[model samples]
Target: MLSQSELLQFSRHIILPEIDIQGQEAIKSSHVLIIGLGGLGSPAAMYLAAAGVGEMTVVDNDLVETSNLQRQIIHQTNTVGKSKTESARAAIESLSPYTKVNTISEKASREVLGQFNSSNLTLALDCTDNFESRFLINEWSVANQIPLVSATAVAFSGQLAVFNRKQEDACYHCLYSNMDLPEGDCTDQGILSPVVGTMGSLQATEALKLILELEQPNGSFLLKYESLKTTFQKFKVPKDPNCSVCS
Candidate 1:
């Protein structure tokens, strides 16, 4: 049950038949783990925390750089030289003090992935730009039988997908077959600010949907967008028969 203040704070959601007080409670009880604090992670964290997701754990070792101001909108000029996780935490704290923001001021690796337990985490979001962290999150998601949402944006395009271990859908490795692509960071290849914002917001929406249990969206669905238009396409993301990790 919501207090008068909570009911009023979430009146818009309470009015929705799909998200009544009960659903809002679900949101208030869910715990989300977000990897990376750059482009995709920024908006995703902002919206989820503001929407009252009970807890958020953000991991990132990098520090805020002046160049990051373009697409990494979470950091301010004064926040430069600060750890990305710290900067992100301050933003979440201000927007939704109700939501607990756990800051991992270090980069996420296979070693640190154990910090997230199945019991502790309700969902995981991969907003990391690199392939290694992305694969690590996917492997951990499968091993722990947790759901993972991942989004990527470079240049003018972006892709979003949900990997559900409970349902045994295609993990991130299965979709791309393997992570053998050339390394490219936003520093080298510029990304449009709006593109990052759009994809990150969608990631938050999918995370909320999973937390609320409103509907099990197609895990295989992919939203590919460019500057001109956006399209949601559904197709099979089959599990790799010879997958080393999640087979």
Candidate 2:
């Protein structure tokens, strides 16, 4: 049950027909795992906390660097050199003290992810930058039948996708099977600040929809953003029948 203070804090959310009191309650009961604390994770974590997700476990071994301030908005100038997980946790707590924030100041190793199965995790958000981390998170999500919302942004381009392990959803490996493909990084490719912000915000949006059981993106569709052209495109991502992870 929402307290009087919580009701007032989330009055806007409770007013929505799709996200009434019941939905707000679900949001307050859900546990979301956020893997990464870089450009994408920053906004995603902030918004999820702001939306009242009851428990959030953020995983990241990296530290805030001065270069990250341009896009990693969750960390401040004073937080540079501090662990990203700590910095992000502080930011989330500042936004919503009611939301419980847990920090894992380490890489999302298989052992770390193995501990969070579907029984405990409500959803997993892949905000990591590299393909390896994305693949590992996808594998864990598929194995445990947990819904996964993944997003990436680099070089003015961003991509967002939702993989519903409960349904006939396409897993990440279905779309990118070739692990050898070059992975883009902000340091090398130069990403626009708002591009990641847009993607991260969308990731949080999809997560809320999933938690609320609202109209969510079909698992087979991929949303791509091109900042240069200011265009958003949606394409069907067919499931690979032989996908090792989801098959």
Candidate 3:
């Protein structure tokens, strides 16, 4: 039930024909687990919180570094030495007090995920920079039948895709054959500040769309964005039965 204050707070969202009170209520009830708090996770977390997700479990093992401030918007200069989870929690609280945030200062692993992986988990967002973490997150999402909104931003390129086990959609592993990725992450190759931010905002939009049950005519597709070219190309990802993770 939305309070009088919440009703006024989300009036713009409620007024939308697609996301009326029912959709807003669904957003309020959804619990999303976000892994990684770097460039992509930063905007995704803030947008989701402002959009009114009932609960968010933030997982990140790294500490906020001075270098991260350029891309990781959730962490500030005062929090440079603090844990990413704590910094993110503090930031989200300042923006949306009603939304509950659970901070996990641990690496993305089955042990950490087991504690929060439950019936209430609406979805999992892969904001990780490396392929290893993304694959692990995908495996967990597939095993638990949870939808995964995965995004990657490196250099001037970004990719966004939604994977659902219940929908028999292609899992994240299906997109990659070799787990070994050379020159992986923004650390190796440089990434533009807004390029990653743009992807993160889009990632949040996809999560809300899933919660609202928006129409996706493109059954199972991956969106690739090249900032330099200012072009977006969509490709279909077919599930591979031989894939180790989902199979």
Candidate 4:
């Protein structure tokens, strides 16, 4: 039940027809796992906390660098030497005291993933920059039948997708399995700050909808954002019968 203070704090959300009191309650009860606390994870975690997700487990091993301030909005100038997980937890707490945040100041290791309480974890958000982290999160989500929201941004472009193991959705491996693509890093390639912010916000939106079951979980989609052209393209992705991860 929402307390009087919570009701007032989330009055805008409660009044929305799509997200009424029941949905607000659902949001209040949901727990989310956020992997990575850099460019993409920053806004995703911030918005999720602001939206009143009951609990969030944030994982990241990196410390804040001076370069991160350009896009990693969750961490401030003073937190440059601090752990990303701790900085993110502080930011989320500042945004919503009602939202509980668990900080894991380590890489998303098997041990870390193993500790997640499956029953309490409503969704996992993949905000990591590399393919390996994304793949691991996808594998974990598929194995546990948990929903996953994955987003990436580099060089003025970004992509967002949601993979639900319970539904006939395309897993990340299904889409890029045979494709040979060079690994790109934000530091090496240079990324527009807002590009990641845009993708992160969309990730948060998709995670919330998936948690509430607000949208039909049909096939998945890969949404591409081109900042140069100011165009958004969405391509439908089907689950591959031969997908080694989700098959």
Candidate 5:
């Protein structure tokens, strides 16, 4: 039940046909796991907080660097030396004080990260840069039966996907079956500030869709955005029949 202040705060969402009062309530009842506090996590967490998601567990091992200010919009210039999880938690709290935020400031080990399965976790946002972390998060999501919204950005290109452990869908592990793929971070390849922001914000949108049970978007859909070309493309990620993790 939304109070007067909350109803006023989310009036815009409640008026939309797709997300009226019932949908807004669903959003308020959700618990989301955000697996990184970098570029994608920045906008995703902020938007989720603004949208009134009930709870969030932000996981990050890195500290904010002066160089991260460009795209990690959740952190301020003053938070440069702070842990990413703390920086993000503070930013989310400021946006929506009623939104409970939990911080995991160390490496996202399987034991530590998977512990959140004890809660009523609704979904996971995989904002990590490396495949290893993504795979680990995917494992947790599959094991817990939680849907996952994953995204990545580098230079002018970014990609997003919403995956679930459904018969027709490919999990993140199915997309990267080899596990030996080379990785590139924003430090080496570089990213346009808005490119990452765009993808991260979309992660928040997709999470909302799932939370509210809107249209039931296929879990295998893959969306690509190119800031340089100003184009968006969609594709289907076929599930690997022999996927080691989700098969």
Candidate 6:
């Protein structure tokens, strides 16, 4: 049940015809697990928590290095040596105290991911940079019949998609077919700060739409954006039958 303060805090969302008290309450009861604490995860975590997500679990093995200050907005110079997960937690706490934040300061491996139960986690966000971790999360999410919202950003571009195992929707592996990525992360190939922020913010928006069960129609979809232009392209993503992970 939402308190009077919660209702007041989310009054703007409640005022929307599509999202009233019920939708805000739904958001307050959802638990989302996010992988990675870098460029993409930073904005996604902050927005989701600020929007009143009930619980958020952030998984990242990296620390706040000086080099990451350019695009990793969640961490500050004072936290250069601190773990990314801890820094993300502190940022969320300041925004919304009602939202619970969980930190996993270790790399997300198959073994580590196996510890999470689908019943406890309503959704999983793939903000990891590597293809291995991304595919692993996709496989685990599909195997557990959970929903996975994945996003990738690098070099002034990004991709976002939603996969649901329960509905037999295409998983991340279905979209990529394999775990082989051509290039490395932003550290190797530089990324614009606004590009990463744009992708991360959209990922958070998708999570909120799913949690609130918004009226808008959403299927296997892909959104691509480039920094060169203000326009974004959207396409209907079909499941790849040859996908080893989902098919």
Q: Best candidate per lDDT, number?
A: 2
- For model 5, state the Cα shift of residue 57 in Å: 0.7
What TM-score, to 2 decimals, does candidate 2 have? 0.97
Q: Candidate 2: what lDDT?
A: 0.91
Cα deviation of 191, candidate 4, in Å: 0.8
**How many residue pairs collide in each prediction?**
0, 0, 0, 0, 0, 0
List candidate 6 stretches off by more than 4 Å: 178-180, 216-218
Total clashes in model 6, counting residue pairs 3 or more apart in sequence or in different chains: 0
Cα deviation at 23, candidate 5, in Å, is 1.1
| Cα TM-score per model | 0.93, 0.97, 0.95, 0.97, 0.95, 0.94
Q: Which residue pairs show collisions in model 1?
A: none
lDDT per residue for candidate 3 within 1-247, as digits (tens), equals 9998889989999999999999999999999999999999999999999999999999999999999999999999999999999999999999988799998899988898777554869988999877778877888887788888999898999998877565557788888764555467788888999999999999999999989989864445689999999999989888787888776
lDDT of 1 at 204: 97
Count clashing pairs, candidate 3.
0
Encode model 6's per-residue lDDT on 69-99: one tens digit a residue: 8988888898899999999898899889999
State which candidate, 4 or 6, has the greater lDDT.
4
TM-score of 3: 0.95
Candidate 4 residue lDDT tens string, 78-191: 899999998888889989999999989988977888776568688899998788877887888888888888998999999998776665778989988878965777889999
lDDT of each: 0.85, 0.91, 0.88, 0.89, 0.88, 0.85
